[model samples]
Target: MSETENKITFEEFRKVELKVGRILSAENLPGYKKILRIIVDLGGEEREIMSGLAKHYQPEEIVNKNVIVCTNLEPRKFGDQVSDGMILAASNDNGRPILLTVVEDTNPGSQIT
Candidate 1:
């Protein structure tokens, strides 16, 4: 199908709450090889987001970085961990996750638009 055919209405698109978040910390989740438990600071609020970036990134590499986050996504459980949001990333040719981050520092919880 054409790209336009899969397009969503502006209202529908707005439903996704994309915001900037600063990674407070990142650590490998126990019993999971590819999952990392990341704590992000979205302005004053902190959220725990589970991401499958351990294979591509080290916990120390992502710590203190600013990244785009989908804050309103429904929480999902990974193993015994619950993810409160999603960290946006691009998949490379090798299907490795390349995290989406701001070129310059931005205030946490700033809207994407």
Candidate 2:
């Protein structure tokens, strides 16, 4: 198949675990210019996620915000933090990252779509 036809199947897409997680806390990574280390509460469990949103968002601006995340990604270590998931965001033409937020308040770990 051509690359265009090689896209993920519906089953594969369903396997991606997208869930809403509330930002319990956020902080700048020491010595890093564009990474924010955030702790997210996924209802029953809390995990740390590293996002390159520092250039667009501040810690105080993002805290308590309900955002979407891929909960099944493999953990990655950056600096001294091990990120357990990825925060979802949209980018503008200018390449600024705009975080995806829920329309209404939902319990953390609520499935997305």
Candidate 3:
């Protein structure tokens, strides 16, 4: 496919609701080695999000970390847990998940754009 074919239109990209959220707590999901159940504070609302970060990060290590979250994504179920939003991350050369985080202190629920 050409580069243009793989690119998304600006209008399409704008539909994604990206917000800053602070991880309040993280825990391993039962029966899943790669998934973690996390509670994130999006301003006043706390959302439960399931992230594939257990392989790369300890639950205690990510607590209180500010991360980018796609808040408008439809909720997805993994086993018995339902994820309300998605935590944004990138893969490294080794294919390990590296979470996308804000460099400075930003208020929770702040728009990413």
Q: Estimated TM-score per prediction?
A: 0.93, 0.93, 0.94
Give candidate 3 regions above 4 Å deviation. Answer: none
Error of 2 at 31 (Å): 2.2
Q: What is the C-alpha lDDT of each candidate?
A: 0.95, 0.93, 0.95
Ranking by TM-score: 3, 1, 2
Candidate 1 TM-score to native: 0.93
TM-score of the candidate numbered 3? 0.94
Q: What is the Cα-based lDDT of residue 112 in candidate 3?
A: 84
User: What is the RMSD of candidate 1?
Assistant: 1.2
- Better TM-score candidate (2, 3): 3
lDDT of candidate 2 at residue 84, scale 0 to 100: 93
Query: Candidate 2, TM-score vs. the true structure?
Result: 0.93
lDDT minimum window of 10 residues, candidate 3? 73-82
- lDDT tens per residue, model 1, 1-113: 99999999999998999999999999999999999999999999999999999999999999999999999999999877899999999999999988899898889999999
Residue-by-residue lDDT tens digits, candidate 3, 49-101:
99989999999999999999999999999987799999999999999988999
RMSD of each: 1.2, 1.8, 1.0
